[model samples]
Target: MTDHIDGALALSWMNTFTEDFHAAQQALTDLDRQAGDGDFGTNIASALRKVVAELPTADDATFASVFTATANGFLATGGTSGPLFGMWFRAVSRSTATEGTDTDLLAQGVAAGLAKVQTLGGASVGDNTMIDALAPASQALLDASTGGLTVDKALTSAARAARAGAASTADLLAARGRASYVGDLALGVEDPGAVTVAIFFEAGAAALSA
Candidate 1:
């Protein structure tokens, strides 16, 4: 009955996300090649590498600190998605500007992050952007929190929803982002940003489960 994710757990989540992204980097780049400039995976890998280098120790870590480091890492990276993700994590940092966060609070942070991403990126759920995964994941977190699920279950639910949303992007004609530039040529290709969002939630779930 872990009721909250403390600084240590939050740090672990970021590390896991970094590892997961590294493993998926080649695949993500290939996916992006179908609809974008094909540098998506390399760019994100660069950002995560910076994030890992800047990660605070568990003893010094707080939700705000961890998220802020992540935000800064992404912000320093080049490209549209990188900066958008930076702002998204920045909002999450603001929401969880404390030592720890319960599932309900985490949900609020994720929802706030989603809102910031949407505002900054000007993309919506069906736009075949990262919002495709982020929007559903945000809603899933809110639902899980309201339903009184444990932290692990709540994160798992969000991860599931995010994966589904990312998968859906494969069938979509991109309405925004780099994929949009390719028009129907991206019909069978999943947006790399959306898949990355799913990976983020999945890493969160795995981090808490461990």
Candidate 2:
């Protein structure tokens, strides 16, 4: 069994994970220029910067505290990524408030995030959006939990699912976001949102493992 993650650890993890999001944003922006708008990197970086600024002080922090701070920050500073990321963090915050952070808690948090994204974005599995990565990663974590897998094992599963989901986008036609405007040209390229979601999952998994 893994130890519970407290407010301090969670805050540290989020700050560290921000770097991964930045890298993923750059990668996605590079990909996007070939098939869609090229501003995803700048947008995600800007939102993450706000998220870092809005993180709660360690003394008063709870999962909800951190998430709500992130949500408010993103909503203020980010465009589409703001609302979407804010919704994800808000949902996860709601789910994790009572549970703290454990393998099961993490899974629940991811599930909450996925539900928010689906509801807010109206994106399904094949939509070539963040849902492509998040839905599968959430389900994989859930399945691992159902099988009584350890936190480490479940996180590994989710990471694999996220990566596979991101890769799968290579063949998908975009159905939402700016990429959708490109039609068939969007095929053979990964969705920036999906790639970024995968990066987030991977970062979370790594942080938990640490």
Q: Alpha-carbon error at 59 in model 2, in Å?
A: 4.1
**How much does candidate 1 score in TM-score?**
0.96
Per-residue lDDT over 1-210 for candidate 2, one digit per residue giving the tens place of the 0 to 100 score: 455556765676577668877656667788879667787778778888887788888897776777677777666765576688778877767656454666677779879888877888888989788889888999998898688787656777888899899999989888888788889988899888778778877776787677
Which candidate has the top score in lDDT? 1
Question: How does candidate 2 score on lDDT?
Answer: 0.77
Tens digits of per-residue lDDT for model 1, 14-127: 999998999999999999999999999989998988888888998899888899999999999998888989988887777663557887888998898888888877888788
Clash pairs, model 2 backbone? none
Runs of candidate 2 exceeding 4 Å displacement: 97-99
Clashes of 1: 0
In model 1, the runs with Cα more than 4 Å from the true position are: 97-99
TM-score of every candidate: 0.96, 0.89
Model 2 RMSD in Å is 2.0
Q: After superposition, how far is residue 152 of candidate 2 from its true place, in Å?
A: 3.4
